[model samples]
Target: MGNWSMFTWCFCFAVTLIILIVELGGLQARFPLSWRNFPITYACYAALFCLSASIIYPTTYVQFLSHGRSRDHAIAATTFSCIACLAYATEVAWTRARPGEITGYMATVPGLLKVLETFVACVIFAFISNPYLYQHQPALEWCVAVYSICFILAAVAILLNLGDCTNMLPIPFPSFLSGLALLSVLFYATALVIWPLYQFNEKYGGQPRRSMDVSCSNRHTYYVCAWDRRLAVAILTAINLLAYVADLVYSARLVFVRV
Candidate 1:
């Protein structure tokens, strides 16, 4: 499991990055900017690009440069293939329902359903891409870098919300979007801070190791049995479930109001 985690991590991120790029390219014609729902749907591309290009690409580069081994690539590739299919489904739905009047608060629904897939990928990759976030870096440097990136991305997201862009305009949705963006950044940055401190703790080896296989209540997993890992896992899992729930609720609302 030395580089299996790192390899799988790189593979998943690469596949996701590829899928996102290809999907966006293909949708350029299908979901043109001239369409009324373009901005609404475009937010999905923004979020995925931020994660895959801005975040995942750098990590994959580091992983390959340092280890250059993709032992368990197939597993991670298969997982992302499923996510790619989900992404395609979202695109199909958008292609079928585009260029129409978005009744009530519905403009955000289709784009948001697609955006939810990216959020879910982030969580699912938490287990697959464990340790990559802080891989191949000194403790202080890792913390500082992640802190800076998360901070800057959060600020940018808030600024985007403040502008006349996306569904975060002219209503209560802006506040919700801002909170979501900041909270996401905070959670990601918090994990970075916690992992270093926890690794340096005198309890779990007292050294900053790459990865660990731990057991929690008979469930064996790759994350260390540390407070930071537990907290991050819980937060990511909660966010994933919440995003799915939001998608379902939005779909229901759109259908009910339309009916």
Candidate 2:
């Protein structure tokens, strides 16, 4: 289905958000505040998040294909299928690895660095692409480029711990990464709509306006204002980077505790 189809996306978003709230919030309530407990909670949440994606992807794909759209749609269908297969492989690997059996924090450092680099790359790409994508609307171009760059830096800070790598701040990389991935999915989907909106505005010379619902006005527009199309791709890339960070952290945490 097209990016504008909120009906399909909403269900997935709501379910995942609820899962996050329960998993993260529950861990904070149940466990003592320590680095040891962090990994357990993260693993639980990551598994749940993956399970939810498994359900949503098949349902959404079937609904999308039912419309009998074009070749591009077919390509998208195939790409998503590959992603689903990859997710399943990850789930299998995670399941086979016994919990609390890995150790050593420094071992995961390289993977975390790679994720930080990826986030920086994505933000830079968005900044460079924004002007070309939304040249007709300077307001949108600036908003998207600025916000994307800012968020990317924020994510990098969170990843690298603001250059004080010695500080073992227990930020849950898996949880953050999953959240980032979900955010990326939203960004890319929105970009699909924004790209067309940008093109339409360019061809027609009309200022693009959004629907006036309060949530849409505040949250949706805020996200959409970030130049929509190119920014969306950047945001999605950031999310994937975040997910990678999470996986690295998870693996690293296991190493530290087990060894």
Candidate 3:
């Protein structure tokens, strides 16, 4: 199951990366930002995200829920992914419709909102999965504490960035990128914390019973861990990171060209 989960995650990540590269690098590069191109781009993104989630949700339901684990984390992750897709679509539509409404620092508010939504989603997932860790005592305590702190920081950073944009606070590209980097780190960190719980289950619960049993009774366990759940998270993290990097590069170029 563990090996299968790892494989699933890798496959999903690879496919998503390819799609993103083609969309942002090839398609966006060739097409002007018009209503026609924007819808096409968004439609592709929506399709990919939904397809990936559909692959993930059933595994999550079968593996986690059937094992006395709550489906909250899986549900939260799915919800977040769905909302993230919608937010991206909205951003593309809004930007195409009102290209000149906001420029410079203020221009990033919509993207920042998307980031905020993602953060909220991550926190919800973390909280939902925390109980599994709590069964481990002191280690769980430390993990939960650290996760809470990071979530608070992420929330604060999002609010600060949004406020800066709203107030026209003269934020530079470096500052924006730094905020994004921090958020990315927090996201991956949260994933790291949550992953151990799944590992624990794979190790102790299910068929293993702490006997190093590699055999899985739940066929969906393999799909859940391997392809469906973790892969979605990995792809989402990659997409956020790529978009952040692109925004940073573009903003830096604008600044440099102006000077």
Candidate 4:
């Protein structure tokens, strides 16, 4: 979790510096990528990253530490992370395409949904750390593969749009995005159902609830019990599935309406 916090903070600092330099130096025209897409995309991910670190750090480490300078610093960091999260969220909202405004794809509804789908996948990846959770069964392992495959597709979509390389695609980008979103929805739906069943249903040698196993209950555990993390993954999978469904709807509309 400490490592997670460090990465988040460093990313925020670097992005802040870069944005300041680009804007102050009038370098937007020289940027290789679309200025509009880059900032909106960066803000989306930065908000999510800071939000994740803010939640994970306090839940994973701050509560376990004794009252000291370290704990105080941890608390301070979490607070700042939350503030950064809000700031970035505001940036996204303020710059997003309004009802009548023309803007980059990153500011549109489907694009925002893509950001959310990726972020939820990131959270699911964070929770599914225990190898024993999925390695024991081929079916459970398939669920892991589903998560990875869908995450990769969504990430690639985001990158393609970010780099303004969607024009290089064979089909219209909206059609491509709609197809990808539909595929992700199916993949996540399968994982959402399979993961919880394999992890919680007693019929599969799984716990029916949170386990009392020493490793799970011990403070040394990074986040939560294995069972709880399993539950978290299940929940995040569902959330991502929904986000993809919404993305599919919006992208399909774009293809049909040519908007």
**Candidate 2 global lDDT:** 0.44
Model-by-model lDDT, in order? 0.45, 0.44, 0.45, 0.85
* RMSD of each candidate relative to the true structure: 14.6, 15.5, 13.2, 1.8
The weakest ten consecutive residues by lDDT in model 4 span 212-221
Q: Which regions of candidate 3 deviate over 4 angstroms?
A: 1-91, 96-120, 123-127, 133-151, 161-259
lDDT of 2 by residue, 1-259 (tens): 2342333234434644664675677753543333332343333333333343445444544445445566457457445545544554464344433434453221243333333444444434644554654576664465455446445743553435323342453656544444444454455345444544543364555334434223234543114443444434545545545554554455445345544
> What is the C-alpha lDDT profile of model 4 across 144-230, one tens digit per residue?
899889889988988897788999999888889889988888887888888888878889877875654555766564647787788
lDDT, candidate 3, equals 0.45
Give the number of the best model, judged by lDDT: 4
> How high is each candidate's TM-score?
0.31, 0.29, 0.37, 0.93
> Against the correct fold, how does model 3 do in TM-score?
0.37
TM-score: the better of candidates 1 and 2: 1
lDDT of 1 by residue, 93-169 (tens): 56444446533232455335435545444443444245543454465344434434543443343334324355544
Q: After aligning candidate 3 to the native by TM-score, how far in Å is the CA of 131 from where it should be?
A: 1.4
Quote model 4's TM-score: 0.93
For 1-259, candidate 3 gives per-residue lDDT tens digits of 2333334345545655665776676674453333233343334334344544544554544345644335666556556656655655565446442544533232344344334434544634533452542454554454445445544544554444434432453675456545654555565455555545443455533222433433223454423222223334334444444544554454455455553
Preferred candidate (lDDT higher): 1 or 4: 4
Model 4 bad stretches (over 4 Å): 212-214, 221-223
Using TM-score as the measure, the top candidate is 4
